[model samples]
Target: MAFPIRSAVAALCAGLAATLLTTAPARAEKQEHAWTVSAGAHAPRARITLDDSTGTLNLSVTRDGRTVIEPSPVGIVTEQADTSRELRFLHRKNRTVEERYRTKSGKRLDRRVRMHETRLSFATPAGARLDLLVRASADGVAYRYVLPAGHGDVLGETSAFNLPPDARAWLGTYRADNEGQFTEYTAATAPTGEYSDQALFETAGGYTLLAESDLTGTYSGARLAHDNGSGTYRVKLADARVKTDGPLTTPWRAMVTGDLATVTRSTFTDDLAPASKVADTSWIKPGTVLWTWLAGGRPAGQSLAAQKAYVDYAAERNWPYEAVDAGWYFKTDAWDTTDPDWQTDSWMPELTAYARAKGVGIIVWIHQRELDTPEERAQWLPTLERWGVKGVKIDFMDSEAQPTLKWYDAVLADTAAHHLMVDFHGSTIPKGIQRTWPHVMTLEGVAGEEKRNNTAAHLTTLPFTRNVIGSMDFTPGAFQRVGLRPNSDAAEAGLAVAYESGLQMFAGTPESYDARPLARDFLDQLPAAWDDTRLLAGRPGQEAVLARRSGDRWFLGGVYAGAARTAEVPLTIGSGRWLVETIEDGTGGLVRNRKVLRGGDTLTVDVVAGGGFAGIACPWRPGVTTCHR
Candidate 1:
């Protein structure tokens, strides 16, 4: 009697009618401290500048000779019941993590630690110390100080204090496969404040940056009953997608909500508007396809037999821009090639001039960490812009907390001001930023071609979750990698035709593009941009199919997994010419670039293997064969 037929219909008709979604919140804490305008012990090392008129808490931290603003966090922590068993457990966790919290007798107290479970982080540099200039306000306790740059790497550590008793604080998902501090809304049991193992995610890099925020803090309880949790911040292993040349700090922890919420990276400083106003963005054109030039290696003139091969390739393909990704500027394989030593004028000037001659633009990579500093950009931005460089690809920018987000927001505004286009690699999924600032051409939010090494199911599931937010330059479509390995899940032609983004780069070696039969055929007719998009079905990293409308044409893409179910997708035009490219059951096949004019324009195809399918829906070009089957 427990058949899916009756159970599903019953759930749909009654329980599953709401469109609400819940998200998790960040970890926050506050302690009250009495304050006086009078400066006393240690005289508050940095200036505590609070402009009550503008509601900004700004403090400058300094060491040796460097200074940085410790921007006031957007929200103050709301008090939680310390008497609660959970609070006691969390306190026990900290006792061990904090080295300073020992007994005055100079002995470790109780040989036990409290609050050790949810320890966010405690950062103290050698020879540098916590200079807490505390103030009590109706809002909350205001603690401000600086982390001097030269304090022996400025060690900061944060552990999300969790205890065995608090394990239920998380939600459950099929991924990660653990019982951790997550809030899952998709499960029927609806364990409040509990996060299943899959609910947690992590990202780390050169800045020694680490962020830990409980996701359940973002979503509402009612919504937390599905999709496990609302917002996602998962651990990324290989795709060291970002490189930084300076220290990067993350202040914003994860927060979630049910409906259309404005994700504010850091909206402090009136610098935003003047930036939008005073900034010159005349050079940017919103709708052009970008190519991540990391197909193989961004070989220098010496590294290649034909020095101009890159420019030639784009010219042949009509690829408007060539992104010298990751290891571009380096003479060696080093990612942070911020050598004031290397002459930028030659490689940049030569490449830019060359690509421009072919009617293509040149975009090179810059470590985001370098941009975080004003001094670095004083020499960096102008140097590259002076060459024929069109824009810069900013890598590894997902410090979704207050401090780091502010840095990125500033970078976007500054890049716009300087007429430089931006692409955020190693980032979170897009959330409509492209609509706001088209200069942000693309972002690497999906498990892109760089991740072809992972299971195809991961690639197949992205359109549902990641693509739903916005554009993903998934570094896609390598026809040959799949040929080499049977399980490549290389929907090379289909995704290039289907995924909706102004920036779509085919990330495969030139050898792969030339040798692979379908790769050539697809890129040959690739358009610059799409006019409209339609979400066919599915969610991120699960299963999804999307349809995009380009001028006088349309593209239908399918990313499939699970059981092979027939999806009866009826078309509005019902009568058109479709140039279909499909991946059926892990096999390479195409439906010919032929015309199909049918009165009943419906597509019912067998979808199997954690793979994909895609096609262009448009009027067949004259002289093309008719595919009226």
Candidate 2:
């Protein structure tokens, strides 16, 4: 499972070079060159234009005849030279890629992708070679840099996403851990600060999600920095320089466009990633996890008795896993687990055995400092595996630098060898890592339930911006109103369906969930991995309605952040009648109802500010009017 970095890069460069030499277009003059590539022969197409007429490589994108990205500069700056200008056009090769694959867990199981690609080779005056690869799909446009063979340092990138004058954006401040609040701002009013990798922009044409994908350990992660009064967001690396020995390729800078539905449901990020590396994925399981730390305080909450109770709760609800968070081990110093003074809780083996008897798995937490080195991982992972641990939650990475990213790859490979799934905490936003390592169940990169600022606006905005790129470990379904924002009981339940994660962590305690039988029943039946997904209606920071299907049943969830409003969601999943069961916010607690209706029927529900609803619809069967189990 170890990624052969050098071999993979060399193979990629060789394949690309062979394709260029075979089907490349005739060499054009160095004066000025331009070409346009469209997604496919169909409406709602995405078009990308590559132009170096002004002596600088620039690119632009349009969706269905409307401009989404203006002409912006694009190139990489290396230690040897600045390849942004004074480059000679070598040749251009065009091809079509048709791909179909299945995901271990995500918004959808089956995925089909078709893109028109153009590879433009260029040479600097100093004879250094660089290739720009552009891909256009029905939902978006992506571009990357490929250095066929090189031995230098990549200083930075000169890529800019230029937006129209009147565009507005939902932007999050840059943090190494990728946990922060996102705010809405006008293009002119956006603060001059570092922003996260993903940003959602509302343009005249439609919605455009600016993101990055296919990031590997070889390079540092990047962010977008905007200047006040300027609509251009330039790419900025997390580290000062990325050292490359040979055959280096940068991550893809992608922009997904269309209506809210298209933007929310698009899989452009995963499409650009490498396929799964695991040969046998039957051991990887995606399901709801009953987390202990969130319900009670740490150390005390992670006690053997408390964890055993959590395992019982998970077993009773048919949930597959129980997460035992930090404080299970004692260390005298950082990264000194091998010291004679260090001690690990003796109850872990017994707990794992007890949980296994009830058909529940145990996932233990470990600090990144404890498992950063290969020696440390070799000493710890096998022991945990021998204890029957199903997974590991590694925390406190808080970095996207090259070294930290490299450690991520090593840890994933080691854990995979040990047959253990992974859940990353205090981590960077997902850059298609799940596609490469299917055992990465979920990651904590958002201001989730643990933050006091987890407001209704934050919850609603996540689906379009953060959650669109990959699985998010938001840890929803909290009933205890403590330091978090005030939300209706139904809103908490609705989040279980609205949010998508391979390992969904419910944050409420056993007592809290037991008090509400209706909401508990809903959680018991919700599936973490989905077969299909659709966005019924939504606007960033305002409200959202999402429908997801698992087999023949469809689940609908909606949340409103502003004043009371009525959401009329159309049930267009299929062409037959359905028996629907719903739970919505009531005057006091929650209300449950049932009805029978056919497809295309509109279900209207009035939601108060900070309120929501959750429902399930099953295909109607003759002599069966109730939706049970």
Candidate 3:
């Protein structure tokens, strides 16, 4: 069910397993000077301890008897110094709450949350007060500072995670385009803005995913910067300052700890975000997009005629959108026309009109630098609206500073007013903004297929890492393989099911996909957005098995690392005979098969070295013929 911001909590309660729980009494065996909160059943028995005297918080998983987070002081930092040292803890209260909600558009269908919530109230020496709200779940823990009625400027947050000496971290490099690769660091030490906000930590017992969530465009974004000398990772704020007048709440600082599947499957990011801002979301449409820049060069790259050709291709394949990438407004080549002004771009309106006639919509490209002037927007935005452009791919937003974020908010608000969908390229990773504004479809935050040297291992690991927090625009479905690339067809086909993006941009020319009839048939039936998503099996950088449902059909995909392997994946489908159409790597092309199986049947698939597999399942009906290739 859809929920507005004002009705979020109430709507959540309607689907919760029980009523709002009352506060529980302090435990008799509690440690001195420490208040403890533990998670519920079905989740690992995790405990979070808060030191009343020093305001230090530590997290531990009791099942494995390991401290996930060492004692770390938590509070905001100002220009003067660390504010945590000056605060004195007053008292604390606890409650138990459960919430069940399904995403309107996302990877998972629904989430059942049972958390132990704690509110630790504290006051500064000068009488100013704030509450550190902590919520502990079976799979993870999150805490945020809640300011009450009054506060000064906040330079940054002092929240830090002190790890053990032997801990290792999977460090994701920071890029203005948000398309850098992840690397393993023994002792991660990076300057501010050098690492992405989310990172993976490997402990003796299991994996821990660290990230910031529910940003809500309030405070500046924050990443973790490690100090190798002290073995601590501190909160690195995007900007040097952010001012709050009266009441303001900070973003949720979260850490999900468990096995690979459990850690990657956590939805704490969406849980902490506010409800949808768009009330009537029937206008938002997510579907496949055919881009011309990947196939054509700049200067009329996706020009009028080029875009028309792609429009015909999209219509022929039943795809919904065709995007005009960079170089649309201005001519970049000597052979093209010399028109740079949008007001006089007669070809744009002509292309949009022609695309509309063909039942295919147009997505235009815009450089953020071109929209820097507010006065220019008076003329720029209306022309696209008049031309009936379905969306805009905004690019080259190279900073995550407060000013940039504020600018993004303005752009989104204006575009929403004009009913234009958005895809952000050359930007920071998404921090659950899609939950707030459904119009914002996907972000280019991973080392996607756009990079020339992107490998199969990168594709396999993405499902468990970057794709977990938000939608990813990997731009999959490339017919040609890179040097030494094996099993390209199966891997590319599996991407249709593995990656989650509202606008799934397939990367190929018409001639490329048209050459393979079976592959083209599969692409014709692919869905851009899914009703449900489940990770059947996954191991980071190795392999992943995924199943997604759209309407009455279920799609399964599996991607393997750089080696050949075979595994039997179990399906969770409805009780009935089903028709399964399978595709796997073949000697020359992808091999297709049709089979009749029960709901509980397990299918064993063999993946070629550096390859993958994809299949579809639906309830079998009489008089249905099976096709094999």
Candidate 4:
């Protein structure tokens, strides 16, 4: 709360006094006010604006009735509530809304509507610039990408619907979207054995993952996608369960980004109702990070040998955490636990203690469909809170219905209240929820690690597609060999880097890691945490490279789909002086094929394909630790 450029606080305090004292007098202005209080905004860069009443900003966004930006010491509004802070002031400015309307002819309709939306922008604190715009609408919301003209990224969007309030939701409605044109998209729920799926949303040329307990709630089946240039897009969701008084509308959240598998820098707002239904909004993280996951389902009843094996493998590698998969004690039958009386935490102490000792936290698994109701959630949440668990990897978004979407959101918020992180398996794509709730961590709404038989192109393209929505925990473990076609360990290392998951689930076994010490080098270079990240080179399915930094050490890893290809990686790897670099040529087998001794005085390299690469660069120091931001 560095004093906002003036004796602004003193003046605000005075205004606050006036506001508090005068509240009983005239009911304050019946409108919202314009809020311009931040000098600090982070970026991949975009310009954003919200128009409730033009210049006279009327809607006062408050947390607990007080306006606070995330991580706080910041305010949603810079000035105190005053006579000047009304719609009269907001009316002073004007902006255009970007959208499309419809009619019965299956074409763009000649129509228009004035939307009073709020503007939320993040000024990138001098790194990779990101800019975005947010617009709230009647049915749902739409986000437009600005700042960089060429960026057309697609991210996943997911929601839960009218789940009797007792159930939790791990969603895969994970939708994807872009700025320029639509892209072919996929989710964890898509029926396999298909070329491309049909668009789910019948209104526009878009799709959704509409899962529900019953079929009545569906406006239509989930929107599958096709020919969507990049990947499939999850534009918006309309939960049918929580009916609005006047019209059917989208959820309170929406997001957009640069590409399917690139970094998501811009985020927008979609909530505009007089009173929002999203009260349990506490668990959301405001920014995105590299998140990974590990499953602990089998570890619960296993011999201590298996438990230690799981823990030690993750611990020694510094892989941050693991998701305790379902069946900790026993599996629930097909009964949807709409009541809270069902106990889901039988092995809490044993598993949690096991994870804590290994220095790896557990993201316990839950089946929202099984315990699918608010009462059940209310019943189970308190118990989970008592378990000392770090997060929950919710599963099985079985259908795409409006009520189901709302149920999913409620579950996310509920999980958040218990201070739990999330990894959505059998889910959708990663949308930009990471910006709103950083704790949402990685989502497995796509064809992630769970299904091992996916093609190479699928693996390669995922980096560019699924990554844009922030971190994705696709459960990327791969110790098992694919077929023996003269064998290639190339993908193992590359996928890890290219996958860009903040909370990564290491793909191989400890024995495998040790067998190929080069793999260890890759692990040693991996950051369990990060301050910044950059998508270096290539695109989805073809080739992709990403570099992230933690303090002085930088971790650069990339995966290429097929045979060898040349890639030039340019990173503003901080303004530093460095000569020479070390890289792991491949994993699974020992041989560090590539070494730097040549005109190593300079930076940059030509990396190969089917082969992932990683390195830690530093100021050439002898017998010294590497220090590079």
Candidate 5:
């Protein structure tokens, strides 16, 4: 189901044009000066209310008869005029959008999304047109602003997420690199500070995750912040303003809602993004990669023999790639290399050639400064391609401003031209960029394995918050415990399946992984990309259990942060019996077992405190007693 990028874009344009020409004024329910737009023609669905009773437009959201978002201001602020309020409603149009697409790598390879869209048109005091586009699906709600045919500098946005005062939230403070832990707080008790776009809330009605999507280089990235003791998180742009010429459409302000399962499995982010821009995507492949920096420091990474050993390890385990982290170009202090003789003297060419001979690819790391411009990218990227390098891991971006985001777009397009895959480190959280550029495999925005202070609760919370948005390069699979509240060996193994990353980087040293044979064997057989995914059972911060399928095999993983407990996992994914193999934390170490179970049968797994479990199930056949890797 590989879609040619041109055809996909054409189809999308055709759909939008048709919607604009054929859609009529929507017949929404009106009470006084308020209009209600229901997600679907049913109860227990998401709803958005537009109120102008006070001579100003305000937006609110509800789910199943419970208020999720209170009345909040919604509009855009431009240099020419302030459209935030005092706007008169013009007309409204409603349409249904159904799209089916396939991804290069994600929780689900094939994705089908259906959303009801409503466009509410308004006019400023001076007759300038503004359109507030709202979209709703079973899993969430999103809204954006469209200033059609006329724009100047967008000063800021007045859109805000006013949550219920009693709701509990898990929020991450705003950082350029987005490498920080999420703190839990109640809406009233939450500190007033800049927060990431992706925030999770447990409301009385259900779970809600606030996020953004379809963020392009034309707009500066945004964060959420509020006054002291206020539950209204207003949108704050990274830069002061974004200049535009003819037309402008801001990124979507999305709120994913429902139960934990619904929140975890929602594809709302990608649903709002544009289709792929690369026409020939057959060269992009996602798989496991051995990273050198976390396993051993720069010294080990600099040594040619050590790199050769890692290449051998990846080759023997049937992995696709091995990543060489920083310090490959210069010894220390100097981040860039301008000396031409270094190319012949450096070991990268030799290493890449040798790795290629062993059926493995090399991914080299570079500082953001090295490829910050077109001339720099043109100078270095081709040399790496000629050296048989398969990918580039760009690091130290550390900003999401409009110019930086534009640089990212340029880098992706340039790297795609060179037929190279991309992994962004020291970067901002993913905002559906992978949907547009499928070659962008993974992004390191979370406090991942490199941050040894990560907790078991952090691992459990990721599948619901950060990872839900897109592919997360958490770099899981570390057998050795280095962090405070360190996870057990089984939990480390389970992370390989629990976390979704297109390019999963194992952070354990070869010796450490070899000592733990069971975990190592599981990593040897694990698939980096999945065809299907399901949340079996779990909650945020306490535990998480996920089942992902690739081909005919099913892989199940669970992680718990609380006290030791027995997790009863029902094998109810498919329709037949299965041959199951499981590994769990034992009193001595890891315990492995094999059994046969039906679709409805349950497998009881005993996990130690700060521990977890991993299992593989194969569809049963006559005379096949053991599940094959």
Candidate 6:
């Protein structure tokens, strides 16, 4: 192991010496000396002040002299001791880091970040030493606590986000699906008993989004709870399942404060996570998959002929993955695995071999309960890996408790070791797992296409909420619209582009795609990863024009509900001419058009109520004015 840097260690050593050698009389004067640190640009300054004598740390963020995060108390609590009281001052250090890297999947193709960091060293009265790290960037501020090598098991930690008493928050309660409707609550009216892991607060100055990041195997997942009429939010760790003996670090409890766009665009969760654990990630391929669940239940889905049909469909579009959803290994009574007539020993090899011949990978689905024990996971995961299964979609986890959180880590660790990809269904929202384990292609946390029908308005709000933090298995590309929703082929095509996911599983069956030939081009061009993303024009619940680029090709689309709307989407497709192809809603299905577009061209798109449009722009010859319709 690399030795700790001498400079950083020196600071900590000095801090420990100060606390050990100082006389009791000097504590009175030390209380008055506040250690102040600042970060971010000149406009929006983020300041953290630590009172060494009292062991209290307070954070305040400001934009143009207006307060964003009020003087909020920032500290941690454990069964052994509370940092706010018994923690004594140790050495401190400051540093800066700059990075530019590509995201494996998500809205943006690449990320460029610069962070200024301050590390405060502290030693408990019991002689335990720890470090509290605060990192400030142009986007927001994030802080986390680090326990030294010999620190014992932890009870809990805190990242209290104390907003103004009058501030209102958009709170999402815990549920099986992360798509739980967000309700507004005032600080005075605390959401007691509500399970809110990610909370977005609307303060007087701007928005403050609080979330946890990089929770792997070391720590338990946490949610926030509040007392009625107190307006004070505290961190509630998942049960008492988490225990650490060696060196351990808690997840980063990030508090991002900014305007709507600034807050939504920040990728702090991904930034806080370590690099990819899968070194040779060449085998990790992400693409649209064909799911059999949305078509019907196992009666219509779980047969050899039915799966082969889906594989045939995947081959036609050159899609890499095809999911044989739940009940593939013999149908059980009423979706319960208790009385199972298992068929994996007999038929799985035949199906996998068949798919391999057609150059299509198979993903099987199983219930999380079935793999609750490590022995069960070890036995089945390796067997599936040997059978040439590319991935597994484990569902019905449905719990945010501490043990459940630990189970997720255990499953991912085993799956990654075997080079098998994973997709979590009926599970909690993603929290930077993709960066830590790139093999975790996607997670089904949102109210995806599996619901049969969804409004364009709800689709618009996702970009700012669910999709911002992590991968969403929002299974797009459903050509059919439910009820009297005025669905159009153009809108269906647009969704395939607008939404972000590592695994872009299409809900439409093979018959649906073959029925509408006009959408084939747009659907086939959908990318599993992107180089950059630009949110052209949008609000939370109105309309959205999202543009994403992969390589030199750019895909743009817009979705809206209610009344008809129009948007002028600007393009910066480098310094070259290109051919812009658009599929728009028409009287009969979709209307296709192609035109010559330059680097600074703006494409105007109009769609009726509950409608959308998708277009693609690719490089073209300078003299190409006449094109196919």
| TM-score list, all predictions | 0.55, 0.92, 0.86, 0.57, 0.92, 0.85
Tens-digit lDDT track of model 3 for 1-629: 45576498777876563443322234432543456566854444435555555655554443355556666667776543355765666787889878776554677656677788888787666777768888878777788888765466678877777766566666677665667777655543433335676777777657777777766446787877766545577788877888666677888887777777677667767766666677777778888888777667565454577778889999998899998987777654321222355366457888889989999999988888766656555556777888899999998888777778878878877888788888898887777688778788888877776677666667777777788788888887767544533336877888878888888888777887877677777878877677777777776677888888888788877888776777777665667888888788778878897888888778778788888888888878897654221
> Taking the tens digit of each residue's C-alpha lDDT, what string does model 2 give over 386-435?
99999998999999999998899899899999999999999987788888
Model 2: residues with Cα > 4 Å off, grouped in runs? 1-32, 41-54, 331-336, 339-345
- Model 1 accuracy (lDDT, Cα): 0.41
Query: Between candidates 3 and 6, which one is better according to TM-score?
Result: 3
Segments in model 3 whose C-alpha atoms lie over 4 Å from true places: 1-32, 44-55, 59-70, 95-104, 109-116, 164-168, 184-194, 227-231, 300-302, 331-342, 484-487, 572-577, 598-601, 621-629
The digit string of per-residue lDDT tens for model 6 on 556-626 reads 77777677667566665566887888888877777887877777788777786777788887778867553
Q: lDDT winner between 4 and 6, please give it.
A: 6
Q: Flag regions of model 5 displaced more than 4 Å.
A: 1-33, 38-54, 332-338, 482-485
Error of 2 at 446 (Å): 0.3
The 10-residue segment of model 3 with minimum total lDDT is: 20-29
On residues 71-167, what C-alpha lDDT tens digit does candidate 1 reach at each position? 2222111121111011111111112222111111100111121111112212222222222223211111122222223332212221121111212
lDDT tens per residue, model 4, 1-629: 56674678789889999888888444434322223321122111112223334322112111122211111111111111111112222122335445432211100112233343434333222221222233433222333222222212212223211111111111222342111112233333233322211111111111111211111221222332222222232323223222223221222333221232212211122112122233454433222111222233344433344555566666766655654554553544532444454455355667668777776676666776644787777866767777677777677775445565556667767776777766666554443344344465566656665454555555555544345434556544354444521114544655565555545666455555676776655665655455555665655445666656566655566666667655556654565454334454433343443222222233344444455565665444455444322
Scanning candidate 6 in windows of ten residues, the lowest lDDT window is 334-343
Question: Rank order by TM-score, top first?
Answer: 2, 5, 3, 6, 4, 1
Residue-pair clashes per prediction, in order, are 78, 0, 0, 118, 0, 6
State candidate 1's TM-score: 0.55
The TM-score of candidate 5 is: 0.92
What are the candidates' C-alpha RMSDs? 19.6, 10.9, 10.8, 17.7, 10.9, 9.0
Better of 3 and 4 by lDDT: 3
